[model samples]
Target: MGRLCKLHIQNDFKEFYTPQVTEGGVVCITRCDARHKTPLRCVYGSCSMTRAGPECECSDRAAFWYQDQVCRSRISKVGVAVGVPVAILVLVTIVFAIVLLRSQRQKEEYRNNLRSRSELYDSDDGNWDAPQGFAVGNPAATWEDMETPSTSYINLERVDTSRNIHIRRPTVVR
Candidate 1:
C-alpha cells in the first residue's frame, strides 16, 4: 500500500494534492498500457491525469466531468491546423470571385463604349449600306476620292455657369 500511495502522490501531487479547487469534480487520470491491458483503477479520490489507454489512444482522462467529452490536446491542435488553412482558402476564393466579376464588368463597359463609338462613325445617308469604294451621287468621285484622308475639326466650350458642364462640336472633314 505504501508503494501505491507513493506512486499516486508522485503522479497526482500537483492536481489532487494541491489545495486550489479549480473545478468541483472527481477527476481520474491514468497511464494504462494496451499491450499489458492494464485497467485504470484509482484507489484514492479522483484527480486529473494523463496516460495511454486500452486502445491506441493516449490522452487526459476524467470521470464524472461536468463539461462535455474532453477533446484531447492533439485533436484540438489538429482542428486548428486544418481550420486555419480552410478559412484562408475560402477567403481567397471570395476575393478571386469579386476580382473576376469586376473584370467582366469592365470588359462589358469597354465593349459598350466601342459599340457607341462605331455607331457614331456610321453614316446616316443610304451610302452607309453601300460597299466600300462605291461612289454615291457623283460617279466622277472614284475610289481615289475615298482613299484621301480628311482633317477633323472640334469645338469645345463651357456651356453652363458651372465648370462641370461643357459642350463639344465634332466635325469629321473627309
Candidate 2:
C-alpha cells in the first residue's frame, strides 16, 4: 500500500513536470512529437521543439504562405501580384474619369459664359431691320456707275526717281 501511494504521488507530479517553464512561466504541456499527432495536428505545417517547447513550422507553398498561429490562414503571393496592378489600374481610371469630368464641366461653363455675354450685347427682341436708305440698290444706279476706271495716272513730277540704289549680284564660283 505504501509503494502504491508513492507511485500515485509520482504520477501526479509527472503531469506537472511535463510542462516547460520560461521567463513568462509555464508554456507547452505536450512534447512536439505528441502535439503533431492525430487530435492536435498542425495543418499545412510540421511541429518542432523550441525554447517554448512544441511549435508548428508552417509550410510556404508556391503561391501562398501561412499567416496565423494555427497555420490555417494564408496570404497569397499570386493574389498580391495580380491585385496590386489591378488596384493601380482602377486608381488610374478613376483619376482619368475625374479629370475628364472636370474638363467637360469647364468647357460647358466657358460656353455658357460666352452665350451669356453674347445675349447681353444683343438684347434686342429679334425684330431689328436695316434702314431703307442702307438697303441694296434703293437709289437706282446704272451698272457703269459701279465700274472702276481702268487707267489712273500718277504725278511722276513729285516722285524721287534720282535716289541711288545698290543691287548685289552673286558671283559664280568656278
Candidate 3:
C-alpha cells in the first residue's frame, strides 16, 4: 500500500491510488479506458498525456449504429403511370361537357322564337291543353284562399322642420 502515487486526476484529487500503464488514468479532455478500470497512470507528474488513445474508442461500437441510407421515390413508379392517364381522362370529360353546353346555347335563340309564335297561335285558338303532351309537373290538390289584400296604406309623417334638434341616447345600467 506504500506505492508512490505518480498519477492524479487534475482538478480532481478526491481519490488516490497506484495504477499500472494499462490502467490509463492520464489527464485528458476525454476519459481514457483503464485495463484494471483503476483510472489514469503516470510517472512523476509528467505532462505526457496525448489526447487520443492508441486504438479508436468508436471502432467496437460502430456496427450497432450502422445505417444504410438510400434515396426513396415519393410516388411509386406504377402509381405515376396510372395517375397520368386518369388525369387525362378527367380533362377530356370536362372538354366534352363544355362543348355540349356551347351547342345548346347556340340553338337557344331559334328555340325561343319558335316558342313565342307557337304560344301566340295557342292563345288565339283558346286551347289551354299543355301543348303537345308536355308533362307540366303535378299541380297541388289544395291552395290557400286570399284572406286579405297584399298591400296596405299607413300615414307617414308631419313636417316639423321648424327648428334643429339634437337627440340623446339613453344610458344602460348593469
Candidate 4:
C-alpha cells in the first residue's frame, strides 16, 4: 500500500490557486504543463523570469501573501476601522467577567467562615461566643461571665407606677 499520507492521484490531482502578485486587479495562473516534480515554480499568469530546470522556483509575490490574486490584501471586520472598537469592547467584557469571578471567590470565602462559625455553635457544648476584639465600643474592657438578670426585659407596670409622665417633647440641641 502507498504511504497513509501520500495521495494517489487519479488525474494528476490538478488543483487551481490564485497567484500572489498582479499589476492592479489581474488574475494570474501558473503554467499548466510544468514538467518539474516540485510545484513550487508553478505560479499562474506570472510575467517574470522562470527558474532553471528541476528548480520549480515560483515567484514569492504569488505565494500565501498574494494568493488572493489582487495587488491589495484582504481585510475583514476584525481589521476594519470599525472593528477595532468592537475588539476593545470584547476585551473589556472579559476583564469585567474576571473581576466578577474574583469577587465571587471572596464571597464564597465569607460564606465558608459563617458556616464554620455556625458549626462551632452547634457542637456538643453549644457555646461558640464571638472572640474579644476591637469592636465598635469598649476595646480595653474584658467580658464578665457572671450570671446576670434579664435587665433588657424590664416590667413596664413597675416603671409606669414609679415615674411621672412628661408632657412636652424633648428639645433638640444644635
Candidate 5:
C-alpha cells in the first residue's frame, strides 16, 4: 500500500499534496522526468530562480510571477481588479433596464385605461369629441362652430430702448 501511494511517474512538482497514510507522509519532492526544468526566471517571488531548477529542489509553493510548467501561481489580484467593476456595471445595467421596462409598462397601462374610458364615453354619440370642459372659452361651441381667427395684430410696443436718447433743444430764453 505504501508503494502504491508513492508517486514516481509525474512530471510536475507538488508540495504537501500527498495522501495521508498510517506510517507517515513524504515531504521531499523528486522529479521523475527532466523535461519540466526551464530557463525562465521569476520576477516577483522571493527568489529569482526558476521553480524547476537543475536539481530536484523546487517546493512548488512560491508565488511565481509567470506561469510555467513547474510553477503556476494564482492571479487573484488581477481577477478582482477587473471582475469587481465589470460585475457592478452589469448590475447597474440590469437595474436600469428593469426600471425603464416598468415605466414603459405603466405608461402603456395608463394609455389603455384612457382609451377604454374614451371609447365608453363616445359610445352614445358616434362622433368622437374632446372630453368634457376640455375646450377653453368654447363650452357651448361644437367643433364645426369654431372658426380660424385672423392674425391681424398691431406691434406698438417700444423695442429700441438701447438707442441714444434725443436731446431737447433749449428754448431761446437766454
Candidate 6:
C-alpha cells in the first residue's frame, strides 16, 4: 500500500506528498499552488505561487490599487479627483492674499509719502496757513496759471459755376 501510494503521489498528486506516518495516520504535505487553493481566490487579481505562499498580482491601471488581497480599491481615484481642485483653489487663494497685501502696502506707502510732503510744506509758526498755491486740502491749489488759446475762424474761397463749363476747342487750325 505504501509503494502504491508513493507511485500515486509521484504521478497523480504533484502538489501533495505523504511525509510521515504517525499514530494518527498519514501526514500529507501540500505544496502551495494559489490557483487550486480555495482560501486565496484573488478575485480582482492573478495569483502567483511563491515559497511564502500565494501572492496577488494586482492590475497596474490608473485609479486602481491592491488592498486586502484584492485590486478593487477606488480610494486613489477619489482622492485625486477631490485633491487636485482643492490644491488649485489653495494656490489661487494664496496668490490673491499676496496681491492684496502688496496693494495695501503700496497704498500705505503712498499715504506716508503724502504725509511727509505735507509736513515738509508746514509752516514753522504752527499756523494752518500754507503757501498760496501749496495748500494740501485744496484740489485746485496745484493748478498752474495759464491763458487759454484763442479760437481763429478760417475764410474759404467760393467756387464759380461758369469756370466749370466745358468749351469746345476749334477743330481747324487758324
Candidate with best lDDT: 2
Indicate the residue-level lDDT of 2 in model 3: 18
- Please tell me which predicted candidate would have the highest TM-score against the true structure: 2
Q: What is the C-alpha local distance difference test score of each model?
A: 0.44, 0.57, 0.42, 0.43, 0.46, 0.55
Off by over 4 Å in 2: 1-41, 49-52, 119-174
RMSD per candidate (Å) reads: 15.4, 17.3, 25.6, 18.2, 18.4, 19.8
> In model 1, where is the ten-residue run with the lowest total lDDT?
64-73
Q: How many backbone clashes does candidate 2 have?
A: 0
lDDT of 1 by residue, 85-155 (tens): 99999999999999999999999999999998776445432122223223234233336436422432221
C-alpha positional error of residue 49 in candidate 2 after TM-score superposition, expressed in Å: 4.1
lDDT of 1: 0.44
Reference-based TM-score of each model: 0.35, 0.43, 0.27, 0.29, 0.33, 0.38
Report how far residue 22 has shifted in candidate 1, in Å: 26
Which TM-score value belongs to model 5? Answer: 0.33
lDDT of 5 by residue, 1-174 (tens): 334335652434343123333345443322332222333333333322234532322333432233443333544556677889999999999999999999999999999999988774552323333433221232332356455323322223523446676899988976
Per-residue CA lDDT of model 4 for 1-174, tens digit only, reads 122112322222223322323466433233433422334343433332233222223244323333343223434433455678888999999999999999999999999999986764542322223332111222232246534332223333334454565799899999
| Each model's backbone clash number | 1, 0, 5, 9, 0, 0
Error of 6 at 85 (Å): 2.7
| Ten-residue region with minimum lDDT total, candidate 5 | 132-141
Angstrom error at residue 74, model 6: 7.5
Q: What is the lDDT of residue 18 in candidate 1?
A: 22
Better of 2 and 4 by TM-score: 2
Global lDDT of model 5: 0.46
